[model samples]
Target: MTGSGARSVYIASAEGDTGKSTVALGVLELLAATGGRVGVFRPISRSEAGERDYILDLLLQFCSVDIPYEECIGVTYDEVHADPDAAIGEIVARYHAVAEHCDNVLVVGSDYTDVASPSELSYNARIAANLSSPIILVVKALDRDPAEVKAVADVLMADIKSSHASTVGIVANRCRPHRRTDVLDALRDTGVQAWALPEEPLLTAPTMAELREALDATLYSGDETLLDREALDVMVGGMTAEHILERLGESMVVIAPADRSDVLLALVNANSAAGFPQLAGIILNGGLRPHPMIDGLVRGLRPTLPILNCEHGTFETARIASHTRGRMATGSVRKIDAALTLMEQNVSQAELVGQLDLHAPEVMTPQMFEYQLLAQAKSDVQHIVLPEGGDDRILRATDRLLRRGVAKLTLLGNPDSVRRRASELGIDLADVDVIDPTESELIDEFADAYTELRKHKGMTRDRAVQVVRDESYFGTMMLHTGRVDGMVSGAVHTTAQTIRPAFEIIKTVPGVSTVSSVFFMCLADKVLAYGDCAVVPDPTAEELADIAISSAKTAEVFGIEPRVALLSYSTGGSGSGKDVEKVQQATELVRERADDLRVEGPIQYDAAVEPSVAATKMPDSDVAGRATVLIFPDLNTGNNTYKAVQRSAGAIAIGPVLQGLNKPMNDLSRGALVSDIVNTVAITAIQAQNLKNGK
Candidate 1:
């Protein structure tokens, strides 16, 4: 694992269904990208007669490995059972054969078909030693806590050590996502390289093809492509058709007796109707097929699901389908992508691959960036308040944030209403602190503080009481009084309503004269910071300079190294309009104040971002063509540019991240998606971290 010319690593697991194949595929992807002719090998095949092993097939299909299924396997499960000693030698010999054909080889080890048999770990360790490959241990952590994960990994490492097989790394696969950080910390205490990939439901949820095979069912009707969609839930169609309508949801597979034509009609009509969830499929249970007449009529409906018929009773069919577990097999494009991305984002990859002599800075994919952002936020958990809890987007985001251990949250809304809405969405927000501003004991105290702060504006206690009842004002008071770390609102309110409280209560930090914002423009290959898009309609030269300085610092806070560009319709003095002069003046002020910063002004957007365009426009400037932070001259230009890029390039604009705040409080677009709310909350948490450190 830590030597030059390192060629192989054995991906071994102590348990079956541990998702070790997914881990192997992820490592194979890293090795293949190292510019080598990579090959794959499986020591013991679980495959049946005249078929390839599913995991080996997956590695060959999705990765750059070119070896055939038949050539990759050394022995069958039966062959291993006959002579365990002989199987180890054969595995080594087979690995050599595959290794001879390529520059590197990845060997997948045994699946502990029976966890009770203590010999699987021993067998894998001996085989790994014989093959002279470093072992990367894969452990089951699906429902295990940090302590249990650590205890299990330590025991495995000791056993592998006893067998004299060198251990390189460990992966806690299918870990509880909320405890992701704890899992890594726990594994690292045992002193091997470690990482945890969070559990994704879709990866384990059985698809229709799996259900069909489980029930031994035949497709009676519908599109073939629908068979790959993962089942979200299973509903037995025993209830009346009207009751079935009550439980209808996305990706459901309804089971019913073949004679229940009413159930079939209800599902079919729901599919055609405007207000129903898109069904995954239906399973017609009980040894009877749908009547020929009923089947023909259902076929006339649009967007048909995969209607399957099986020869089992409804109870027996449901049992079979429920027990079906999905594998990382062929024809699942989405699961493949998700597995690779999840592994890629959550590993100590450089250490795992460094021994193979691969070295390059990875471009931060959006998935990677978001992962890092959440990790940063969770490093020091912050308390963030959501004033727009009535918005479903906010509540959903709150659920995700809590589940990921990203923040402690308080929602500003009526407790009953929030609880009722959360129940409808099937999300548990029971533990989240709810503050009904109107009914809070702190209302009187908060109103008193508000009146005292705004007395010069003719504010009285009675007037302050009314203002504090508004969620925004109350939430800001919570942050200002050190009751919460930050606040994210405006999903249902306007920007003015969300931040006006912040402007009055929390105010600006030291060295910042003007309040501004930056939208993290996540492009395909890189992320750029676009500034003052959602604030500051117009500014004088001095104010624009303050905006640039603040934006550059904000970019740095979020891991973007700032090379500032003051944008205009000009490029480095090529134009002579007043607008160009304004940008030029702001540029000078930025340089004079922040001499350590790399900044350029009167730069056109194309020249600021496009290297080819910069070559002819401003080739001599260090900030041109590679700017990470773009400072706009005015609101009209900045707002319009960010939106156009967001729509045209499909870039994710993850802000209006407010800068220059004493404490972190942010606004959201009214049309924000749940993902946007989650990201914004994370940003606020990170900002609170910086504030806590007095940065």
Candidate 2:
């Protein structure tokens, strides 16, 4: 099972003793041997020694993570007697944490009783629902007649294939050697995807050395000592700089003497090498002095590799490396390898999108599934509001989206005036809908509509009437009245002004308590959604919970299963006071109310992001280290923190997508360029669809 990146395989069972864990472990072992990052999570593990811990120990041998086991498994319940809902909550929390560290996670199932009682399986399915992981049902070949197997399989298949599941497949285990072909054919005939275990015994144990080699790096430094060579990609530095560049191209750790500038030059050259081979870092010999330039360059590229100044010279290091070669192929590759295998499984419509910003060219280019989804979405037209109507950039962008069958176009300006400007700018909008607020069918309607809606809200009829005449308010009203599906304004408005109309007329959806904004912060490896950066100046604990829940939902809508980290100065009871108390309370509230959400907070940004930092601080908290959704305490913290990460870390900030609105209407910054408008419009449209469906 091989692919470009990690893929996940979720495991369920038709009945107890189906051997889902054994199969999952086997797959994990196989894949982890191929230099893949694998992770495992049991959405429901009630066994005295939960299956998750077993898998965790196995994964630790191959992958690099310092998070404690308790944090990785959010809640541990009594094996025999425990509340299923409570168990599900803790399991989802833990599952999200593990899923964040790797590309794919193996979702293990709870126990399965007889087919006479489907509730047992149903409880496990609900946990999968909460985690939002794809599923693979494990069926026992023993004790099942053909009819019973098919019936049980059919029921499990339907349950796993509900709308909430991202994808699904099947694994049939331990078939009699002679009946294997017949059983496989029968299972395949059920129209459910399945994998049959081999008659030959499969070793499910993890081989550490194999994993080390798979990562294509040396065991210069690691937690374990039994370094395997096949799993080890030992980085050997030729005594010269040119060799370092040639051999280190995106490989692993490099060992050399510090006194050699030639070696330092080689170290520097290795980092800039084509594809930037994964240099674990330089292992300096004889504890020699490093050049200042080399030190600075290495510092510039930190966390990727660390310069280890050891007293041992090149000769001793080589001897250590030589001993590690044959042991690479030993560890279980289940989690990571399963993901790679599953990625190669070729499930239709399960597109693995790159973790980049929407503004990136790669995100916009239509892939097969995306093209089909967008094409089908064409019938669902949305009303788009552009602030500066006649600019070349705006018109060109609008034309491209329209030509691509994205949405029905609506330009906000006088038809004649816009026509004159479009002609001068050489932009064509011949068939686009051009509305002047002064003469708009919806604006005139919204002006009176706004007056009626806000008449009793401490505003006089004349005051409300005049306010509706304003562009922002009018634009928002059109969205509220269903005169338009959604609105995108603010090219000429500030955050307050653009959002004012929403606050005044549109307001929050009826049940929603707060209106918060989140910016989708995209990086090379992952996409994070940060909230309250553009709304809720200083939110209370209740408001913070609302923000976290809202942001989590938004992340789900964008194909990101959120691992929310509620950020603060402290982590996991590290600090005390009302501030920390607020965070703690909000975290509990989220766990209680938003049952499907995987959220943790009251953590520092470092603990929330860096696994190494998390290992040191709040090592037992599930949300520490691998959090994808970061919720800030107040606007001061949230706004400044996101901005800092963006500038300092070169993170791509997208959206600030306005949430808690009755309609999917968003405001752009006045300084928003044409591309920003395009992205905002896309996000607004998606939200509009979700709102209509009552999601």
Task: Score every model by TM-score.
Answer: 0.63, 0.47
Error of 1 at 369 (Å): 2.9
**Per-model C-alpha RMSD:** 9.9, 21.0
**lDDT per residue as tens, model 2, 525-603:** 4677899898898888899998998898888887667889887778877799988999999999899998777777788
lDDT of the candidates, in the order given: 0.82, 0.60
Per candidate, the number of residue pairs that clash is 0, 40
Give the Cα-based TM-score of candidate 2 against the true structure: 0.47
Q: In model 1, what are the clashing residue pairs, if there are any? A: none
Winner by TM-score:
1
